[model samples]
Target: MFKQLIPIALIAVCTPALAAEPMVVQVKRLSLDTALKIAQGSIAACREKGIQIGVTVVDRDGTVQVTLRDTIAAPITVPISEQKARTAVNFNAATSAMKDRANSPIGRIDGLVMSAGGVPILVGGSALAGGVGVSGAPAGETDEECALAGVAKVQEDLDLAM
Candidate 1:
């Protein structure tokens, strides 16, 4: 009798909850068009300095949205750029600044490269929308500059879309 009562009680409690309205959530995401523009702008910025490079853009979830490689850029640059973008998104800051965070145990986790050349794409209230990473520049600062150019190029577009 006690076993039967337990089942009945569970059902009674769950049935009413099932009848309640489900909640909805809205999640912000990055578009591929914007990602492409970021890549192009970053590459162009580096080209101005006579440096051929690779650029990568990733969505908020750290998924690759677009990747661009200059004609003379090394193949290794592709992964480096992507990794940098992912790192930035994961850290919610520029990848170049990740070294400071890496002083903690959690920041030292494997698969995260606390290197330069990565910048987070933030939206309203500093929410992360995606990230952009530039690789193959002569210096990390230059790489970050290119990434900043990429964001600037699409700032208006992103604001309008958002």
Candidate 2:
């Protein structure tokens, strides 16, 4: 009886410690409307430069939200754009800045592209909201410019939300 009571006492003593607080987290997510605006803005920017391109927007989880290809863009640009966007969101940085890692082992990971066209979308210039990628431009820098233009289109709204 004493042995059973000791075990029970220990259980009672440890139970409170085992009690965990309920975990409920809030996270910001990109809306479809915003994703469309980003994709359209990127395409418009490329159009102004006489470049037909493919644009992709991905949420923070690296899930694609929108993909837009200009009428004359090459079909290959679609997958490349999506990969770039996924890479940006996964790494939480612009693909252009990761040039050194392009040939590294990490870059070899599936579904990730280390190209310069991917740009992370941030809320209030801090919280990462998503990523945008542009492909089919003459140069990667040009693609990145278009991606940045798209993010700029919603910069004010993002800032205000913070």
* Top model number, lDDT: 2
Runs of candidate 2 exceeding 4 Å displacement: 1-22
lDDT of 1 by residue, 86-115 (tens): 999988999887777767786677756677
Residue 66 local lDDT, model 1: 95
Alpha-carbon deviation at 90 in model 1, angstroms: 0.7
Give Cα distance to truth, residue 101, candidate 1, Å.
4.2
Q: What is the lDDT of residue 58 in candidate 2?
A: 95
Q: For each candidate, what is the lDDT?
A: 0.87, 0.94
User: Model 2 over residues 4-69: C-alpha lDDT tens digits?
Assistant: 899899989998876764467588999999999999999999999999999999999989999999
- Candidates in order: C-alpha RMSD to true structure: 3.6, 2.8
